[model samples]
Target chain A: MDISAVNALPYEDFVNIFGNVVEKCPLVSAAVWTRRPFVSLADLEAAINQFIDALPESGKEGILRCHPDLAGRDLHRGALTRESRQEQAGAGLDALRSDEASRVSRLNEEYKRRFGFPFVVCARAHDKASILRELSERCGNERAAERARGIQEVKKICRLRLQDLVRSDNKL
Target chain B: MDISAVNALPYEDFVNIFGNVVEKCPLVSAAVWTRRPFVSLADLEAAINQFIDALPESGKEGILRCHPDLAGRDLHRGALTRESRQEQAGAGLDALRSDEASRVSRLNEEYKRRFGFPFVVCARAHDKASILRELSERCGNERAAERARGIQEVKKICRLRLQDLVRSDNKL
Candidate 1:
């Protein structure tokens, strides 16, 4: 919908629209209700960014901690969100050969261990091989630097999810 | 100092130790050679974690693009070897008001757009705030999930660097 259309949404309706974008974080969406009728997708994303930026380190960490590992344990258990399921499948993550799958699985564990969080990247852009490569390389990132990268990745997912739910002529 | 006492080495020898860390990337170390042995560092990070996974698409792209985007374009202007300068300037990236730094400076870009690159959880190890938090959340990945994430943010930087790099460690 156009920014004008969004301004017209009722509070609950607006939150409902964006709440889905961040998955479990309805509070972020709810909090953003005060900033209505954004001028562009950038405006909407910016508002979301501001709210997240202002959050306590723990709150932000809470947000970062919200994501799963790439080709992670959650994937095998069928625990992924509907959006996540499609995204992972988009990258051929579900079709991994046994050896490939296990390597990715191991990387996930080692990443989380090294970084104090799961290894993250924008998996949709690459493939099983690239994702695994990133997992290993990023193991070298400083914790603080990696965390910054994590939040950025999550927001990307939200933006894509937002594009799915809303339309825009302005750049996203 | 010979290899045993890496600490005592004159500058030229020190660079030799880590120059081998990334194979075929002589520029990485020949550039780093000016810097000497890092005495305070722990044992060298394992080499296995340095291998790029079999990302046919990205691998092809990697061949095309060649160098990693160290802090993005910053690598090009005599900054690749300036590791010490960057390590000292923490939080500056987090505070970026301009989009350029954020857009080109993402780790995702540095990693995919450089590769080396791997999880399980004890599952019972962390809480929902940390776990489901991890699961549905990491879906925002730009692994190319990062690129997708990055393009969103890059568009953001390019829109503001889309969104500045997310600075956290849950996985992205």
Candidate 2:
């Protein structure tokens, strides 16, 4: 298939393919679609930026839905690989001695009580201490800001994920 | 776990935990570790950039191992969801009439011939036509460059998967 052929696709077909992606992971779809008819890679990136900026305040929760629970040991239909689970949990609970583990447990309880959800961060980029610090700091963020931030973080994660998917397919 | 606790752990433990992640997906671990001791969200992103820049010549091959093989159906431990497979195959070959079906088969064959592997793309992000176009254009790329790009994309995918895992845990 050539770019010309892709460009020639009826908008409905194009939308249908992309719409499924958007529905599954709206942020990623938004990032990709924000740049329509991708003339070049740079243009594609710009569209991604524009999409991120244009996301509605109400849409944040939808974006957040794409992420799985932290320390969620069980596998779901479309969960992360086993390797990913170990990595996030390892980093999340990194250096807890017995006492610190209790404290972390307590904090987890209290934070959940306050926010109505487990603390979420883009764990891939954070170390143990940094994550804890974020946990503490975000505990104080008004619910709205924290939720918005979570959505933003999720979007970043989606972009990264989509990029990886494309790369893997190309290799195949 | 506190930062000190993470630091206090035996180096082997750190390696053991983080090692699984890297082992499952080296590009992802590299993407995460490149940003060690992430103090701020900004720091974490900076590390991701560094990882992208420092990717090795062979990194693409390393990432390819993370993707499941492409078949008329799914077969790997973790690949597309069941629903995704159903959607990808369409109602059946009969639904495609003859020409459309032949075109898909031919494109799949050409893609495999040029890349020495199945035409892989995050089907979620593309329609049949766009995917076909990508297949043709990417076939033109030198193996080395294509391989590098593929690995980079895998890194992105792994990170997104990890995020999903963490979010799911938090929800629980």
Best model per TM-score: 1
Candidate 2 residue lDDT tens string, B49-94 = 4543453332233234323333332332334544334435442422
**How far does residue B19 in candidate 2 sit from its true spot (Å)?**
31
**Which candidate leads the pack in lDDT?**
1
Report the error of model 2 at residue B80, Å: 6.5
TM-score of 2: 0.39
Give the poorly placed runs of model 1, Cα more than 4 Å off.
Answer: A168-172, B1-172
**Candidate 2 ranges with C-alpha deviation above 4 Å:** A1-27, A30-46, A72-113, A116-118, A155-172, B1-172
**lDDT at residue B135 of model 1 (Cα atoms):** 30
Candidate 1 overall lDDT versus native: 0.48
TM-score of chain A of 1: 0.88
Q: Summarize candidate 1's per-residue lDDT along B1-172 as a digit string, tens digits.
A: 2323544543223333333233222222222222334332221221111122211232212211322232333333544333212321332332334554554335333343232210111122343234334433433454545323322221111211111111221212
Q: How accurate is chain B of model 1, given as a TM-score from 0 to 1? A: 0.24
Residue-wise lDDT of candidate 2 within A1-172, one digit each (tens)?
3334434443323333332222233223322431356765345445544553543442333333333344442222336544345446657654456675665566655665564444566666777778767777777878678767775665454454435433453322
TM-score of chain A in every predicted structure: 0.88, 0.58
| Superposition error at B124 for model 2 (Å) | 22
